[model samples]
Target: MAETSDQDSKTEEPTEKKVRDALEQGNIPVSREAPIFASMAALMVILTFLIGRGVQQITLTLKGLLDDPDGFPLGAPADALNLLTVVGLEALRFLTPLLVIFAVFGLAAQLLQNAPNLVLQRIMPDLSRISPLNGWKRLFGTQGLVEFAKSMFKLASVSAVVAFVLRSSEAKAFEAMYTDPVALPEMILSIAMRIVSAICIATIVLVAIDLAWARFHWRRELRMTKQEIKDEHKQAEGDPLIKARLRSLARDRSRQRMIASAARATLVIANPTHFAIALRYKREENAAPLVVAKGMDVIALKIREVAEQNRIPVIENKALARALYEAVQVDQVIPAEFFRPVAEIIYFLQSKQAPRPEKVQ
Candidate 1:
């Protein structure tokens, strides 16, 4: 077990990319407490605000039924159907608000519990879910044990709150048993309300703690190993070896273009065997001499060979060659400071006067 954990286990937090990908697959932190809390809260709302109205409506309905036994619209099929529709509409009008509010509360709780993410992957079937071994593990594993413990805790807490409420109101309840029928309902309702309110308040506290625990557990579950992080990074950026090869190919192609451009240069400035820069000036095209080709080492030698084949003059100027190679790029005009020196080289080549060529070292 320890060796297995050491292989690809994670101790670090999940990266943002990992979290986002998980979300896309419908993996998100969700607490069971959210649904329970929403249900309890909705129940509380109904008990506090709608219960009296519901009781009054029921009372009216019963009274209406009893008040005219003969006139009750069950005389014929048409009359009965009409009466049922009227009663159904009336009930729906009163009850729809409560139902809608309950639904809203539950939906709001879920939205607040998890970032809103919709993914079709969640509905995809998984064979593992139906496997007997997986079922057994779900029922007997650590998560199962925790759930059992939580259920027991909730049951005990609610039972205790109910017992406390009843015990506190025991005397009133006993007295109400012998009192007038009209006041008995009020007394019973009072005790029931107290019990429900206490239970809801207690459960709210439990739900809050459960929600925090669920979020922490989910984050831990999503943690990634070092290898996983590295793989994800590579997938996002690209493979390093492939990228290096591509760069080498690009540089070689660029070098070929530069060497070819050297054939049209007015002259080649050589830094012995270390560097070479080919200068080209077209009075109609450029305001200053342009470094048509530039290269180092073997590429410098190729640039010189190209110049020799084109009968372009080769001058030895170590400083100017190095400066041009370092400061200017192929096809770019020389800087203002190097203008006079490069212009003299261009002028010497254009004059058709063969200056003494520097010997190849």
Candidate 2:
């Protein structure tokens, strides 16, 4: 009941990370019947392309041996060993090609269905593998039932195909009784081929269905709940609260830098309490007055304090202060629109500081 509820809750499609992890952990689905079909194909190849030549070669060798068994003096155990060795060599020569074909077919089937990789998780020791309760649960589980059903289906299909093929070839089988002994194997091979071909066709259909179901089942198993998706996103992107804290720290550092730089101002324009802009003028530095710092409220107060401590002039101009605070940034020159008003301020300050002209008398 708990498992079913958990599965029901996992309604969201699996994320890319989940699918990738499943593959790395060897959780991919594969159809078992694909290998059986491959073996049947290998058998078909052996019957069609290999068996005739191989059998003829073996038969010629064997016939020569049996026809002249006593042609040479063979009264020793060594002679018997030699005869056995010859027979063994002939058997291997005939069987090696068949074995190689079967191996290649089986490996190709697996390779076509799945990419090969080494996954230690599959081979790791686990007590659950040995526990009887767990084993029993597995035996009666949904996957176990599915496997059982597939086996029953394959058995029934093969049995029916074989029975039908044999029934249709019944007359041929009886006729083989009067046929030459040499031709009996050929007749049997023909009937066997029909049976095998029918079985292969049946299994091909089953394999197709199994492959589709396997992929669907695997993807379903990988689904996540809404909460799980959120958790994964948090893990990748970090918590919102923590990120906000980091941004706040960055802003604080920037404000401190701006306040510390206020001591370099030539003059501070202020709105008495809310706005402040620190300007620096030098003919060699820039064409227009540069805004060294600007801020509002508390930061504006701090800039004013720093300017006063450095003995920099602080003039009250509400409109200019507010306009500079809105339009200018630190280390940037004021815009051309404010050149006339600011140039007048600079001329007034210069006239105030000019030395009195000395009298000639």
How many residue pairs in model 2 have overlapping backbones?
0
lDDT of 1 by residue, 58-91 (tens): 6787678789766765868998897788678778
Q: What clash pairs does model 2 have? A: none
Q: What tens-digit string does per-residue lDDT give for candidate 2 at 1-361? A: 9989999999999999999989999999888889999999999889888998999999999899889978545799998888888889999999999999999999999999999989999999989999999888788998889889999999999999989998999999889888899998788878878888888899999999999988998999999999999999988899889999999999999989988888887778888889989899988888999988889999999998998788777778888888888888789999999999788777766767524211111
Least accurate stretch of 10 residues (summed lDDT) in model 2? 352-361
- Report per-prediction Cα RMSD to one decimal: 2.7, 4.6
TM-score: model 2 vs. ground truth: 0.90
- For candidate 1, the 10 contiguous residues with the lowest summed lDDT are 352-361
> In terms of lDDT, which candidate is strongest?
2
